[model samples]
Target: MPLILPDQLIDQEVLNQENIFTMSQDQADHQDIRPIKILIVNLMPKKEETELQLLRMLSNSALQMNIDLVRMDSYQATHASQDRLKKFYKTYDQIKDQNFDAMIITGAPVERMDYQDIIYWKELKHIFDFAREHVFSTLFICWSAQAALYHYFGVPKQEVEEKIFGIYQYEKKKEDPILKGFDDSFYAPQSRYTYVKEEDLREIPQIQVLSSREDTGVGLATTLDHRFVFSFGHWEYDKETLHEEYLRDLDKGLATQIPKNYYRQDDPQGDIIMNWRSSGSLFFSNWLNYCVYQETPYQLEKIKGVKVAKFGGSSLASASQFSKVKKIIQAKEDREIIVVSAPGKRSKDDQKVTDLLEKYYEGKKRARDLEVMIESFRKDQAAKRQEAQEALAAVRTRFQEIVRDLDLEEALKEDLDETFQDLDKTQSKDFVLSRGEYLNAKILARALDYDFIDAKDIIRLKSQDQLDYGESYKAIIKTIHKGQRVVVPGFYGANAQGDIRTFKRGGSDYTGSIIASALQSKVYENWTDVSGIMTQDPNLSKDAKRIPSMNYQELTDLIDQGAQVYQRDAIDLVKEKNITLKILNTNAPEEGGTEIKDQEDK
Candidate 1:
């Protein structure tokens, strides 16, 4: 069977020219069987070139596949226009909720910087989390493999004194499905500035080394489950990829080395060897058949669910807390609807984020305030900062005379003022107070690579304090599609006039309830500090025990008696919808917590 792709893929003509069989989406839709859905997170700079290389490898499989191309929303590609990206590619936000049979994340030209220093590092991490729960199998290539190692296993990549640029030989270390048809050794292209220590990966119990070379360390590795596949060398690279890189590096005045074992008789002007194409095709085929097509559910929606999870302030207090929350979400593929609250204190002495925002808002605002905020946001490593500053300085100096009359500072101020010109005193206060949740949701959304759906955009209210459920349901349905994971700030919604209005201090639980009700979710999870509803407050009684299960009436009675585990309104909403409500602990999810239902199970 031929590969199935979008109707207007820009590289379809190129693939056709190479004798690759491909069918359009419209043509595939008429078929009775479901095509394997594959998502390609293309991170390479030359979008069209990388598309052709990857598509050629994917076409080797007998199973038909529908390809969805995704691009980084944070990084703008100078090589491709915005129109091309809009038409041909999707952002992580657009498909995070959707499940995939397999995913391919390509390498980028950012091996020099520290992983955290990359502009889209947080966003990429989100995609990594998504792959864990949403994708059946994911192939990470080159720099992306190094990134996956660091993100998933805490294995770091060390900067090599010289770039490993060549077509190198790799020996198979294991008899695995991925290397089922491979020989004792195979050749692939390697162009990288950093390498991961083989010893570090071997120490992790979950990871297995499939192939390696003495000079290149670990060329291929996978998790014990085989859900994640990593390749240090580029098997999908064309015969001329390295040649183009070499020439481009030379043009930039960098000391570049000729690719080894690539050109005929080692001559720069000679014909390319092109020895890796067969192996690349076989590898992709094995992955599709063994890792994805066989293991993924025939009905993709069978793996999906409308589960809502609400995380409180303490659960999102620090960066480490955010990482914990991401792992919790990854634990279950069905945990799709995520609700988040404002940041809490890092320590007993630290002020609450809401108070800090209120204080900042009540005080006089200055340009220096904006600088401080921007400085805090741009907390990249010193080396990266210096490099960026130097580059900016050079650009400014070059453009000094050409734009001598320009007032850069005034121009920046004007842009900032124009963005916030509509905020009045009341609206400004609401906006500032809401920033704690808005900013927290934004950070979490970037970290999870999921869509950040603002509550004001979907959570409609009839008046300042009353929710308009009818209108809100329609808005939520329109904003969120089937199979997408999204993050929404809690405790606030928009009134008829579109002014931001917040609920009581602990109203985030209510926000969670509304979303669960709107989506008609089967289970609404409230993640907090406590494991579940307790017979007694743990703070007051060291002997308090977690309630295993309770009926809706019992929960309401406890709420009437002043149990602060859930808001009364929130409980009522879920109760009316007959949705099971689970109270779980973010700190220790293994404890299992408590469950509330309309009636106790016999």
Candidate 2:
């Protein structure tokens, strides 16, 4: 292997495991990048396991990342052996002179203990002072969070009668660097019995609460200066780590509570997978990208200063508003994109858009047009069948374990029927899957907190209002470019006479790309769940290295020549403009998303 590993390693294994590292040979060759340097202080019970978990989260970043383990000898948090620490851990004395781009302190089993009583309290205090003055940004997890919080603010830890175990829902506290691109509600794993109380932490004038669980206390917090981030919740933990702990405790005669808000049926015997890992990787990667990679000085700073530094400015404050517009614009700007049916249900238990649209079409009482729509609808129904098949595949093993002795054919038919019935009620695609794009935009516009003008406001742009198609587009573009983002629905037209006429499907992507090209943005950032462009199909490659940057022709070739990554019409919209479309993991924007541009073949 070269300095960087081959971007695609055992491609089949990647797809099989659903790992998001897939990359093409061209991407690998062009992106001759170096690994980011990170320091991890293991304060947990299982040092190496935590090491692998943290490294796994780091692995998803496009950059090469090297991990340095930091060990403290004074505490009873004996996760590592003396030999192992000597062999792999770098002592503070040896590394105090060096600076790191990023640092993570793992959770220790000392939260219930007093600060002065702990054997390593004095040394850990020194680490705290050093973190503020020396390190670029420090991420303190679990016990480290409590220790740092109390040490810096004198906010004390309170013991809990119950261990807060399992997956907990965390509401985003505020728009900050560490919480970028996170949804309103995301999951984090909490497995601690004690935490710093909010009232105590609130006493500190400089504390910034990033997130908090109503019952679990503060989920995450940061110094007002923003240099130190403390996550009371274990967002960096592996999905099943808590489960393992729970099971171990149960086996050891230690009282264990079933992880609350976990295991759908609330059955302790029910099977569960690590859904929280996705959120974990997404959150930490954002921290590394925004706080460490983007903000930290590339040059290392020695521990020469210990003065307190204050960090807040209009620049940081102003970014939150732009981020909303920027991320949506980015999600809009991708080509060769295969849009799934219907936008996701807005809420976990909301009706889909497709069903309501279908019902409305039926209510109009047009036999022939309704027939045509139904045929189109029936095809979507077929697609949903395939989707259900895949969904079933996901829990094939679990299905066997949970629903064993089931009738094979009858169950399959029943599953397919349920999937189709649900599809009928749910709106799958907005522009690509259904006609709900217009409706969705109206809702989304209201949901947003900025300037919005309906397309109807521009009468000339209406289908029957006597405006040219290009003219209406230009007018809408004018509004959007003037910093007023609006949605222009697909499949509609306004004549020179300003008469409205409707068109076919899939024009929204083209409109978005054209608008992006005209605006001369650096790159179109498309937000979606997966990481950027891959070498083989996501189904084809598993450990597909997420491509960093790439050429345009290659992108087209990938889409055109068997890749099916995007639609050509959208690519053609900006081909002349040479606009680059970057596909980002909406879940992990700081993973340095993949960019698509015209390539220079070697």
Candidate 3:
């Protein structure tokens, strides 16, 4: 039950004074047991304080643990001693190859800033990616939880009008291993400027909300498999953490509110209420026993894999659908690379954007009408933030540029005769058709706050009808960074002469497959409107049932027989790579969708 830590950790003296049992590496080596390896990616400015708080909570567990501390090497620490960090902590690069039973990423004070603007954001993404493949389970605390939610699922944190700084009561919402103790309601400390909505979390099928409150929103949540745990409240905070935060804020001349329910009679000088300690200890103990110790493989090296998710047109049709796409992407950490199709029909009577573009290209629709449709789509995708508005304007300008040389004699087409002379009609048509996906990817990237990668930049085409796989693989490797969530437009790529060429309609599925095969992803997830492949078309057969799973050969046979659930070429690509394919419903994700895999692998 002793914690194995560095011999001279800066906080060791404080922990010793508190009578927490700790052992040096030399002493732990002499022991016969294989101590659980725990990595702590400490992000709090007060390094020593955070270490003591986390070490105290972890010390309550009966299982012995070897705690390895890590710091972000990309950013220099101003509050903590550089000498101490160099001596007691390791950087991400130093331990990138090592596996751990569990890892804890502490909260930082960068919640208000955009994720990309943070100096160490790139480095932290690598750490997050490493944990997904190497660490058995990861616990994200406060701001880290928000960051992880955004990075993985595209769930953005909304800033509240006031900071939630106090002890709040959260009621148990669901029964799970992470919340094993008996408690209908419990007190936990909350000190944050932002919070994630329970409604948003509920949309993600993979996440299970464990505890929540009317006032505090979501307090605790975890993935259904317990691989990732998110704690919005700081259960590891010391009794005076809030008090110190209040004083610090006041000293800086900022308006500060008294921490609610933390003192007798709401007086700062009154006796402090320490009701959360018992629940906090029980929570950490349960996490160790149930979430980590019982589930992790004895050999840590056995843990490794990644998933590529592709959202179809129907799944990313409207603003609401776009939100669903973000949640699905964020639900699993391994779903790092996202591929998106153009907006589809929002309702039975609605028209897909791609169809509208095609009609305009064929001269069946007016150019003015097409422009109006595109503008409406742009407004629907805007998020009411400055960045989204800016993206909206940029997307509108790009659309205008693409249609500038159109043969239509409208106010939109000026100097059409001169422009037509220079325009290659074939290339212009391909560019116009691809804008549906291009604009959607731009909007989606802004909404999710992820990098936007144009498919033409990486996916290479040998000709209008032929794909260049070798060149595409090399280009994808060169352009995309490992572990970064990026949004890529599907259906179109560039040829050897740098001319834009498009695959046949419904070719986004093929785009996803190529990326999955190029990345060697363990699984390729295709999200559509239906739960899975049905035995018969639901529109025709009232008793149509969903197929839980099928083999690659069976799927190929179905395609050969004219089943239209997936693209035939996409199926061939994934089959050749031996990548497992999952057919998921973006709307009704809880239903176990169909899975396609090689028979031998299954």
Candidate 1 clashing pairs, residues 3+ apart or interchain: 97-483, 97-484, 97-485, 98-483, 126-448, 126-449
The ten-residue window of minimal lDDT in model 1 covers 398-407
Query: lDDT by residue for model 1 over 541-564, one digit each (tens)?
Result: 999999999898998899898877
Candidates by TM-score, descending order: 3, 1, 2
lDDT of 3 by residue, 165-230 (tens): 899988888777777774888899999888888988876645788887766677999976677899
lDDT for each candidate structure? 0.79, 0.55, 0.81
Superposed Cα deviation of residue 153, candidate 2 (Å): 1.1
Ranking by lDDT: 3, 1, 2
Better of 1 and 3 by lDDT: 3
Better of 1 and 2 by TM-score: 1
Q: Candidate 2, residue 362: CA error in Å? A: 91
TM-score winner between 2 and 3, please give it: 3
Clash totals, every prediction: 6, 45, 2
Instruction: Please write out the lDDT profile of model 2 over residues 402-465, one tens digit for every residue.
Output: 1232223343445434544543454322211333333333323333333334333232333432
